[model samples]
Target: RALNVILVLQCERRRFLRVGLAVPLLGTVAELREMVAREGHIPPEQVMGGMGGTGKGRDPLRATEVPSAVPQVILAEVSPQGFLRSLGDSEELGAAGEGAPLYAFQPPPARRPGTANPSPLAGNRGLHSLDWLGGQGLPASPGAAQPEAQHPLPSAARSSDCLHRGASSRVLLLLCNTVSDGHRLTRFGPPLVLREERGISWEQLQQSILGQLRALLRAEARAQGMGVPLFRIRLAEGMEPCTYLSPQDPHPLCHPAIDRALQLSGSGGPPHVRLMAEWDLNTKERLFGSVQGEAVEDAESVGLQQQAHRQQPSCTLDECFQLYTKEEQVRGTAG
Candidate 1:
C-alpha cells in the first residue's frame, strides 16, 4: 500500500523538460504545497495547478486548487508512469533515468523476503507479447457488435447488484504515451470481461495485463528510449492503475479507494484488473504477437485471493460485515 502523488513540474515548457516527483498522496493541499516547497526549495506560490484526470472532478487534489497569491505551479496528479513519460531524455534531465521511472520522495519498499534491494519483481521478466490482448485488434467489420462494458456495483450489499443479474463486467484498458509531446499516443486494448462462470483469478488477470503493459513500455518504446510510459483501466468515472511491487511483499498499504475496491471485489461484485496501457502503437508491430518472455505461474486464483483476504486479521472486507443498515442503526438507537 505505497501511497504517493506524482507531479510533473513543467519548468520551461518550451524546452519540454519536466522534473517529475513522487510525494506522499495523503497530505492536505496546503500541507502538500508546504511540503513540496520545503523539500523542493520552491515556494508554494510557484506551485499553481492541481488537476485530476477523473472527469467528474471528484479527485481529492482538485478540491485544493483554490486561487492563491503566488504563481502556483499547476500541480497535476498523474500516475508515476505518466509523470515519467512526461520526462523525455537523460540529456534533457542531465541524469540517467534510474529505471526510467519518476523520482520518488518516499524510500523504496523493501525487497521480497530473501531477495536483495533493487531486484525487479519475478526476476524482472518482461512480458513477451500483446497478441492475447485482443489479437492486434481486428480490422473493423461493418456490422460487428461492439463489446459492452459493465459498470461496477457498490461495495455494500444490495438486492439490485450487477452480479445478481448474472452479467459479466467489461473494462477498457488504456495505455498512454506523453513523451511524444506534440504527438502523443493513447491506445485502448480490447475490453476485458469479468466472468463468473469461470473461476476468477486476479493473478492471471494481473499477468495478462502486465504482459500487455510491459509489451507497450519496453526499453525500445521510445526511438529515443528516454520517456516513461503508463497504462490504466478506465472505469465509469475514474481510472484504476495496475500496482507494481516486490513479489514477496504484502500489498502496499491499500489506499482508501482501493480498500473500498477490494471490499467490493471480494463481496461477489464485479471485479477487474485495471489494464490501461499508454504506448506508441504506430511502431509496435514488431512486438505484436511476439511471445518470448518468462511469466510467473500462479496456482491461486482471484477467488482464492479474496478468500485469503477474508482470512486476514482486521481485513477491511471482513469489516464490511460489521456495518449496519440505516434502518437497523435507527432501530438500535431507538431501542
Candidate 2:
C-alpha cells in the first residue's frame, strides 16, 4: 500500500513538471530590437530617437509639440490553465481535516547503496503549491469568468505586468532626416506645399513600400532557407524638408531631397543603384548623357584607326617595318 502511494505521488509530480515546462513561451523585447537593428544596418539612435523631447512635434501645427520617444515593446505571460478556467465557474479544493496526513505518502524504509532517499512530503511543504494542486482537479473558481469579460486576457495581463515592471511591453521606433531652417524650401520643397502635398497619403505610401520590400526580402530569405523575419518599415511622423541646391547657383529646377538621398546611399550596390534610377526619374532629361559622350569618343577613335589602316598604300619592306615602329611609338605615347 505504501509503495503504491509513493508511485502515485511520483506520477503526479511528473505530470506537474510536464505542465510547468510547457507553461511559458518566452521572448525578450531587447533581443528583437537588436535583431532588427543589426539586420537593417540602422543606427540604434535612429531607431530609438533622441534622448529628450526637444525636437519639433510630429504634427506641424501643434503649438507645444514634443518630440516623440520610441515606444516600448511588450511581452505577455499567459497562463493557459488560468485562461481555460476563466471560461466558467470552478469548484474549490476540499478542506483539510484536523490531524489528517498533510501528504498522502511516507518515505521508503531503506536507502539504495549509492543513492540518497528524498524526504517524503517535501514536495507538499509549500502551502501555496499544495493548494494549487489540491484545486487543480476541481472545476475553476467562479471569479475566473470575470477576467474573461473585462478585456482581452492576454493584453490585460501584459499591460498589468508592463505597468508594474515600469517598462512598455509594446515596442516602437523612429527614423528621421535632419533638416536645416535655411534649406527647407529649396531642398525639401515649400513647407506649405509639402503640408498640402496629399495624394496616396503617407500611411498608404509607407504600407505599399514596406509591403513590397518585405515581399522581396522574404523571397530572398526563402531561397536561402533563412528563418529570420524581414525588417519592418514605419514612417516617422512629421517630415521636415531641407534644400540642397548649389550655394553658387541655386536652380529652382534642382531637387535637394533626391540629392541628399543619393548621397546617403553611397557609391555601391542597391542604394547607389536605386539612387541612379531615382535621379534619372527626377531629372527627366538624359542624365546618362556623359556616358553616351564617352562611348561616342571611343567609337570615333576606332573609326580613325580603321580609316588609317585602309588608306595606307603598299610600301617597301624597310619602309613598312619603319612605319610599324613609328606607329608603336605613337601608341605608347598616347597610352
lDDT of each: 0.29, 0.21
* lDDT by residue (tens digit), candidate 2, 237-256: 11243122221221111223
Highest TM-score scorer: 1
Distance from true location, Cα of 123 in model 1, Å: 12
After TM-score superposition, the amount by which residue 166's alpha carbon in candidate 1 deviates from its true location, in angstroms, is 25
Mark the regions of model 2 whose C-alpha exceeds 4 Å error after superposition. 1-25, 45-335
Score every model by TM-score.
0.20, 0.13
Best candidate, lDDT: 1
Q: Which portions of model 1 miss their true places by more than 4 Å?
A: 1-185, 193-206, 210-255, 262-275, 280-286, 289-335
